[model samples]
Target: MTVHVLEPACDWRAADVADETRWTLELSPADIAELEAALACAKARAADLLDVTRDDFPLPSLAPRLVEIEAQLIDGCGFARIRGLPVERYSDDDAALIYWGIGMHLGKPWPQNKHGHLLGDVTDHGKSGADSTSRGYELGGVALPYHSDGSDLVGLMCLRKAMSGGISTVANALAIHNELVRTRPDLAALLYEPQPYDYRGEEPKGGEPFYSMPVFTEHAGRLFVRYIRPYIEASQRHPDAPRLHPKAREAFDLVDAVCADPAFNVYMDLEPGDMQFVNNYHVLHARTAYEDWPERNRKRHLKRLWLETARLTDRPEKFRNFSSHWAQKRTKSELKLDA
Candidate 1:
């Protein structure tokens, strides 16, 4: 098979967008006021976070900007951040409600785990990385390697910052894919073959402990990627799972090498009230390990959302709502925090 390079507009280097303005939006005072009014409207109606629709939390003015942001995520840059939400002015629940409302404007909420959490929490959950069933988001103080989540879009809204570290890192997977195809088509080609991933114990009852899907797929002349090295590595623990082919191993290593190169990745410090969103197919994200404050209120926390965007209508079948099997067990992830 002949592997072809896809030079999407999102093929940006860290230096190309290091100016921040290229990818970050500092909300204007009017924008903030508009959000406040929207929040008030949603609250007045006593809307449940999960039940809130775009109509429920109206963003009359900011809605247009969100549409452009969605375009940027899918076509231009593959990632973006909206800063200045005045989170301290509201309680934790209120802040989360606001995050959920904004997320509604971008896409439909997708379940993040077996619990079918439309909204999830990212913080220390006391799970060890060594635990086979533990997902990276549940564990803390450890670096999460570059990987894409199980959705078209993934978002995080910071409510508090850690005492140290925890900087967010995003790598241009599109650029990495094109580079691999240009220099080493043989290795890049292998990635299009099916690769096994562990279910992390989320498989339906009596189902396989692991499943297989390709890391790179092409559909309707667009490139789509679903790469999570840790999960792929963990699948090896299942005897029934297919073994990683030697060529595939080489391909995975090349992908990892490209992601680790500073030229392909950019780091961002997410302060409280900042929200970041990334197109899962075009970008792979990670984080630095960090220490947390002892006080519950001071500990780092970020509200998380896995979204299905209308802008990406041509995704491969395998990547669409892959978590629906877990949706029957719907629930949210909550952390006990100080008020």
Candidate 2:
């Protein structure tokens, strides 16, 4: 693998507002009005899409008009917020709708919603809940390490945070990539090799427990990244999985070095009503460990969506399934795994 460095061009907007990386663009009255209109229309939409009969789609469908609104917001700020909750909030459908709708705007639908996933208090089979951590020392409320997921983009809405902690973090993948190329060419080359990744128990039917891919991939001379260290670590549990070569370990260390620096990252404390969408291939993000108050109902809960975005970066053909474009056009929750 060849190391290549491409520094960002000077831009007043990108530079002027460069503190800690959490860019906050206050919405204008028009933006807020637009949001209210979309929210109203979404509530009016009734697609039996979320009905169980439509297996892949497990959430109500928002009208095209509302979806357009979400796209505009994503293009401008990479995130948006929508307020108001259902009066009869019996299920998590409403939350699902909001997450899915925004994801549609960002990219293609990658049918995965960690369905009814429980964090601290879960009592279901296939439990990968908060128990796996040693001594019950869950990384709750601690700033989670920065990593990317297996999608073009990820949508997260701050449903509710704990009384304290749960801050979000972001790091520009491009910055980190460029740094590796400039400072450690040998390490950068190792990123081209396949690195095993755990499914976190989410995979297609009869699929292996883990799969392998480079945490760092480059296509068309551009960077395409997917890194989740914890999941990568977990994949080690499978005996058949390949071990990281020394070169891969060196690359990981170099990546870590760049992430540890503020020059490549931005941190933010998401406020209520704030929703964020990230370019998963270009950004690495994480959350700080949080404290929850079950007795008082203050728990840190976030709705997550995996999106296949309209914008296509150059990538190896394997990553792009033939139906990827079509998948982007469909409504969210249309693709569901048994999980």
Candidate 3:
């Protein structure tokens, strides 16, 4: 396969964003008022969080800003942070509505897991990272390696901050890919080959426990990435899964090494009411291990959304069908909120 190279539209480095101002968009008082009014309108109409639509939660003043944020995710920096919501003034339910409503303006909600939850809770659920079937979001107090998620865009709205640590970091995968091609074309080529990934016990009935997808894909002149090392490593537990090639292992290591470099990553501590949105194809994100309050009510919690953006027109065929089977067969039980 030929190595595809393109102009750096979204390529950025840590030094490019030395201050939080680069990625942050603090909402104005009018913006907050508009959002609150929208929420009030939705509540008056008896709209459930799951049932609320962009039309239902109209953001007249804030809609333009949301548009700009979406553009930044697709074309500028691959990530954007919107802060300054009065999270303390609202109940958990109301805050969730505001978040969900804002997300609706960005993109259509995509299911996060096999349960087909368009909206997901990101709090510790007493899961062990050592377990082959455990997903990173299910485990608490563990640092996550930089990796892309299974969506065009992924968003997290922080409802509560951790007691300590849990700082969020993002690395520019686009820049890393370009650097790899310039420095190590051999290693970069291997990333285009299919790699086995574990389904994390969410495999469809009668389907293989593992699926194959390339770490990097080039389609219609755009670079798309989907990397999750833990899932790839976990695939080894399945007897039928293909063994990882030695070259593929080297490629994985190289990608991780590049991502871990301080020059490539930007770290930020998410405060309550801060909403972060990232382009899954261009940015790889991680979080430092955190300590949560012992009291359940005081624990760190963030709401998550996987989105399919309108801006991203063409993608690899595998991505469209990435989790289509499970999504089609999803039941009401899978849509229920676990938290």
Q: C-alpha displacement of 126 in model 1, angstroms?
A: 0.5
Q: What overall lDDT, based on C-alpha atoms, would model 3 receive against the true structure?
A: 0.85
For each candidate in turn, the TM-score is: 0.97, 0.71, 0.95
Pick by TM-score: which candidate is best? 1
lDDT agreement with native, every candidate: 0.89, 0.53, 0.85
lDDT score, candidate 2, position 336: 22
TM-score of model 1 vs. true structure: 0.97
For lDDT, the strongest prediction is 1
Model 1: lDDT equals: 0.89
Summarize candidate 2's per-residue lDDT along 105-203 as a digit string, tens digits.
445555432332211121112223343322111234445677875566666665566677777777666667766677777777677678898775544
- Displacement of residue 100 (Cα, Å) in model 3 is 0.4
Give every collision pair in model 1.
none
Off by over 4 Å in 2: 6-23, 48-99, 113-143, 321-339
| Winner by lDDT between candidate 3 and candidate 1 | 1
lDDT of 3 by residue, 61-103 (tens): 8888889889888888899999999898887778888998999
Candidate 2 vs 3: which has more TM-score: 3
